[model samples]
Target: MRQFFVFARKEFYHIFRDRRTLLILFGMPIVQVIIFGFAITNEIKNADIAVLDQSKDHYSARLIQKLTAGSYFRIDRNLQTPKTIEAAFREGRIKMAVVIPPRFGQDFFHLRKAQVQLLADAGDPNTATTLVNYARAIIGNYQQELNGPAALPLTINTTVRMQYNPALKSVFLFVPGVMTLILLLVSAMMTSITIAREKELGTMEILLVSPLPPHLIVMGKVVPYIVLSFINALVILAMGVWIFGMPVKGSVVLLLAECVLFVLTSLGLGILISTVTDKQQTAMMASMMGLLMPTVLLSGFIFPVESMPKPLQWLSNIMPAKWFIIILKDIMLKGSGLREVWPQTLLLTGMTIFFIVLSIRKFKIRLS
Candidate 1:
C-alpha cells in the first residue's frame, strides 16, 4: 500500500511538472464546451432577408413587420421586381425573400385565402427550411388573429408540448457530447501517450523488473489520470449548468458514478493502446485517428444515428460514445434512473472488461 501511494504520488508530480500536459488536461475541456455551446449552434439568429411587397397594403405591411419583429430575421433589402430575388440570393446578401402577391389583402378578406411566396436560398437546406418555417408560423399567427376563435368553419386545435427541452437550445444537445469527447481524449489518449513515453525512454522495463507486480505498476501509472479525468468531468458539468443552463435532472451521484465508469473504460482502452505501441507519437496518432474520429462522426454527437443508412447504423452501434451520449441525455434531460440506463451501463462495463483482458494478455506477451 505504501509503495502504491509512493508510485501514484510520483505520477502526479510528473503530470503537474509538465505545463503543456496540464494545459491540455484542464484547458481543452473548457474551450471545447464554450465553442460547441455558443459558436456551433442549430438556432438561427438575425438572418438577413429581402422583402418584395407587391400589394403595398396594410395586411402585407403588417405581415412583413411580424416577420422581422423576431430575432430570426432582419430585412437587408427591399425588392421592387421578382428579377432581383435571385440576385439577392446569388450575391449572398439574403438567406430568404418574402414576396406578397398583388391584392393580398383583397384576396384574404373576400376569398378567405391569400398566396404568399417564400423564396429561400437552398444552398443551406437546413437553415433555409428553418427560415421558411419561421416565416410561415408568423403568417399563420397573423391569420389566426384576423380570423378570431370562431371565424373558421373547421378547427383542429393541436397542442404541442416539447417535453425535455422546451426552448430547444442547442447547448442542451451538445453538452453531453462534449463531455463524452473530452473524457475520451483525456483518459484514453493521454494515458496511452504517457505509457508509451515511458516505453520510449526505456523506463517501462525498469518498472517491470522492480519488486512491484506488473498490474500494480500499471495501476499506479493510471490512478493519477483517473483522478484528473474525474476532475475534468466535474469542471465540464459545472460549466454546462452555470454557463449554458443545462440541468442535471437525475441523481447527481449517479451521474458522477457513470462518469467514473466511462473513465475506467477509457483507461482500459488506453492500456490496450499502450501495450501495442512503442512510441508516444504512434500512440497519440492511433488514439486520435482510431478513437477521436469515430467518437465524433459515429457517436450521434452532431448527426442522428437513426437517420444514417442501415450499415452505418450497425457500425455506430459499436461506438462507445453512442451509448454514453444516450445515457447522458436520458439522465440529464429525462431524469432517468439506473433501471432506464442499465443496458448502456452493461455494454460499457463489458467493453471495459474486454479492453482490460486484452491489454493484460498483450502486456504478458510483450514481457515474454
Candidate 2:
C-alpha cells in the first residue's frame, strides 16, 4: 500500500507536467458529447415489433401477415393484451406495437371504418418514425389492393404513439454513446500511452527493480488514472443531465457504480495494450485504431448492430463498448435496476477479469 501510494503520487506529478496530456484527459469528452448530441440519422432494418390483435378477425390477421412479410419489421411479440407493451419496451424487447381493436371485421364491413394503434419506442426516434412509416406504407398498399378499381367506404386509421423520448431528442441517444466512447478512449488510450511512455523513457525498469511486486507497480500506475477517468465520467454525466436534459431514470448510485466498473475495464484494456507495445506512438496507434473504430462501428454507437452483416454482428459481441452502451441505455433511459441489467453487468465483469488476467500473464512473460 505504501509503495502503491508512492507510485501513484509519482504518476500524478508526471500527468500534471504534461500540458497536452492534461488537455486530452479532461477536455475531449466534453467536446465530443456536445458534438454528438446534435448529430444523428440512419435506416431502420429488421426492427423488432409486436402485434396485439384484440379483434383476431380476418382483416386483422391479413394486416399482421402483410406487416410480418415486410423486411422492415419482425414480429418480436404477439402480445395477448395491450398491458404488455410497457413491459416489452422496458425490457428492450419490441421497438413498436400494433394494437387492433376488437370487432375489426365488423367495423370495416358494417361501420365502413377501422382503427389500429401503433406504439413505437422512441428511444431511437428515427427508428421509431421510420418503422411507423413502413407499417403505414404496407397498410396503405393493402388498402389500395382491397379497394382497387372502385371507391370503397372502408378505411383504416393508424393512431401513433411514441414512447420514452416523445419529442425525439437526439441527445438521448448520443449522451450514452459518447459517454461510452470517451470513457474507453480516455482510460484505455491514456493508460496504454502513459505506460508505453515509461517504457520508452526506460523508467519502467527502475520501477521494476524496486522491492515492490510488478503487479502492485502496475496497479499503482493505473489507480490515478482510474480516479481521473471516474471524474471524467462524472463530468460527462453532469453535462449530459444538466446541460443536455438527459435523465437518470434509474438509481444514480448504480449509474456511477457502472461508470467505475467500465473505467476499470477500460484501464485493464489499456494495460493489455501497454504489454504488447514499448513506444507511446505505438500504444496510441493501437488504442486509436484498435479501440476507436470498433467502438464506433461495432458497438452500435453509430450504426445499429442488427443492420450489420452476420459476421460483423457476431464479431461485435467481443466489443466491450457494445455491452456498455446497452447497459448505459438501460440504466439511464429505461430506469432498469440490477435485476434488469444483470446479464450485461455480468458480461462486463467477466471482460474486466479476462483483460486483467491476460495482461498479467503477458506482462510476466515479458518480464521473464
Candidate 3:
C-alpha cells in the first residue's frame, strides 16, 4: 500500500513539475475547445445578398425589406439587369440573389400567385442549404400575412423544436467532439509515449527486475493519468455547459462514467501501442498517425457522416471515438439517459476490453 502510494505520488510529481506535460494537460484542451467552438462552425450569418427587383412594386420592395430586416442575410448590391446576378455570384460578393419578376404586386393581388426567384450559391452546400431555408421561411411568413393563411390550403406546418441547441449553433456539436479528441490525445498518445520513454531509457528492464509485479507497475503508471484525464474531461464539460449553454439532458453521473470508460479505452490503446513499438518516437508517431488522424476525420467530428463517401461511412463504424462522440452528444445535447445510449456505451466497453486484452498479449510477447 505504502509503495503504491509513493509511486502514485511520484507520478503526480512528474506530471505537475514538468512544464510541457502541464501545458498539454491544461493548455491544449482550452485552445482546442475555443478553436472548435468559435473557429469551426456551419452557421452562416450576415451572408451578402444581391437584389434584382424588376417588379419595382410594393410587394417586391416589402420582400426585400423583410430579407434585410432579418440578420441571416444582408442586401449588399442592387442590380438593374439579369446579367449582374451571375456577376455578383462570380465575384463571391453575394451568396443569394432575389429576382422579382415584372408586375409582382399586380400578379399577387389579382392572380394570388407571384414568383420570387431565389438564386443561391451552392458551392458550399451546408451554408447554401441554411441560407435557402432562412430565405424561404422569411418570405413564407410574409406571404402568409398577405394572402391569408386559410387560402394556402396546402399548408406544411412544421413544428420543429431544437432540443439541445434552440439556436442551432454548431458549437454545441463541436464541444463534445473537441473534448473527445483532447482526451484521446492527452491520455492515449501521451501515455504511450511516456511508457515508450521508459523502454528507450532502459528503465523498464530495471522496473521489471524489481519486486513490483509487471501489472502493478503498469497500473501505478496509468492511475495518475486516469485521474488527470478525468479532471480534463470535467473542465471541458463545464466550459461547454457554462460558456456555450450546452444542455446536459442526461444524468451527469452517467456522462462522467462514460467519459471514464472512454479514457480507459484510450489509455488501453496507448498501452497497446507502447508495447508494439520499442522506440518512443515510433510509438508517438503511430499514436498520431494511426489513432489521432482517423479519429478526427472518420469520427464525424468535423464532417457529417451522412455526407461522407460510402466506404468512409462503413469505416467510421470501427472508430471508437465515433461512438464516444455520439454518446456524449446524446447525453449532453439530447438529455438522453442510459436507455438511449446503451448501444454506444456497450460498443465502447467492448473496445476497451479488446484493447486491454491486446495490450496484455503484446506486453507478454515483448517480455518473452
Candidate 4:
C-alpha cells in the first residue's frame, strides 16, 4: 500500500513538474470550452442580406423591418433589378436576397396571398438554408399578425414545440461534444504520451524491475490522470451550466459517474496505445489519428450519424465518444435514468474491458 502511494505521488510530481503536460492537462479544456461555447455555433447572426423590394409598399417595408429587427440579418444592399441580386451574392456581399413583387400589399389585401422570392447564395448550403428559414419564419409571423382572429380557412397550424432546447442554442448541442472531446484527449492522448515518454527515457524498465508489481505501477501512473480528467470534467460541466445556461436535467451524481466511466475507458485506450508504441511522438500521432479524428468526425459530434451512409454509421457505433455523447445528451438534456442509458453504458463497459485486457496482454508480450 505504501509503495503504491509512493508510486502515485511520484507520477503526480512528474506531471506537475512538466510545463507542457500541465498546460494540456489544465489549459486545453478551458480554451476548448470557451471556443465551442462562443465561436463554433450553428445560430446565424448579423448575416448580410440584399432586398429587391419592387413593391416599396407599407407591407413589404414592414416585413423587411421585422426581418432586420432580430439579430439574424442586416440589409446590406437594396437591389433595383434581378440582375443585381446575383451580383450581390457573387461579390460575397450578401448570403440571401428577398424579392417582393409589385402590388404585394394589394395582393395580400384583396387576394389574401402574395409572392415573395428568397434567393440564397447556396455557396454554403447550410448557411444559405438557415438564412432562408429565418426569413420564411419572419414572413410567416408577419402574415399571422396581419390575419388575426379570422384565421385562413384551410391553413393548418403546425405548432412546433422544440423539446429540451427551446431556444435552439447551439451551445446545448456543443457542450456534450466538447466534454467528450476534452475527456478523451486528456485521458487517452496525454496518458499514452506520458507512458510512451517513460518507455523512451528507459524509466519504464527501472519501474518494472522495482519491488512494486507491474499492475500496481500501471495503476499508479493512471490514477493521477484519472483524477485530473475528473477535475476537467467538472470544470467543463460548471462552465456549461453557469456560463452557457446549459441545464443539468438529470442527477448530477449520475452524470459524474458516467464521466468517470468514460475517463476510465479513455485511460484503458491510452494504455493500449502506449503498449503498442515505443516513442511519445508515435503514441501522439496514433492518438490523434485513432481517437481525435474519429471523435470529431464520426462520433455524431458535429455531424449526424443517421445522415451518414450505412457503413459509416456502423463504423461510428464503435466510437466510444459517440456512446458517451448520447449518454450525456440523454442525461443532461432529456433527464433520463439508468434504464434509459443502460445499452450505451453496457457498450462502454465492454469497450473498457476489451481495451484494458488487450493492453495487459500486449504489455506482458513486450516484457517477455
91: Cα error in model 3, Å: 2.2
Candidate 3 regions off by >4 Å? 149-158, 161-166, 302-315, 364-368
TM-score of 4: 0.95
Q: Write the per-residue lDDT of candidate 3 for residues 1-368, one digit (tens) a residue.
A: 67777877888998888999889888888888877778877777899999999999887889899989967899899999998789889999899898999999999889878898989999988788889899999998998878774665586767988756787788887888888988998888778876688788877776677666666666777888899999999998898888877888889999999999999999888888987887889998998889878988999898888899899999999888999999999988788899999999999999988987777666642443
lDDT preference between candidates 2 and 3, better one: 2
Point out where model 2 deviates above 4 Å.
40-153, 364-368
Comparison by TM-score, 1 against 4, better one: 1
Indicate the worst ten consecutive residues by lDDT in candidate 2: 36-45
Residue 275 lDDT in candidate 2? 82
Per-residue error for 160 in candidate 2, Å, reads 2.1
User: Candidate 1: misplaced stretches above 4 Å?
Assistant: 364-368
Alpha-carbon RMSD of each model: 1.6, 13.4, 2.7, 1.7
Displacement of the residue 162 alpha carbon in candidate 1, Å: 1.0
TM-score quality measure for candidate 1: 0.96
Best by TM-score: 1
Q: Lowest summed lDDT over 10 consecutive residues: which window, candidate 4?
A: 359-368
Better of 2 and 3 by TM-score: 3
Task: Please report how far candidate 4 places residue 365 from its true position, in Å.
Answer: 7.0
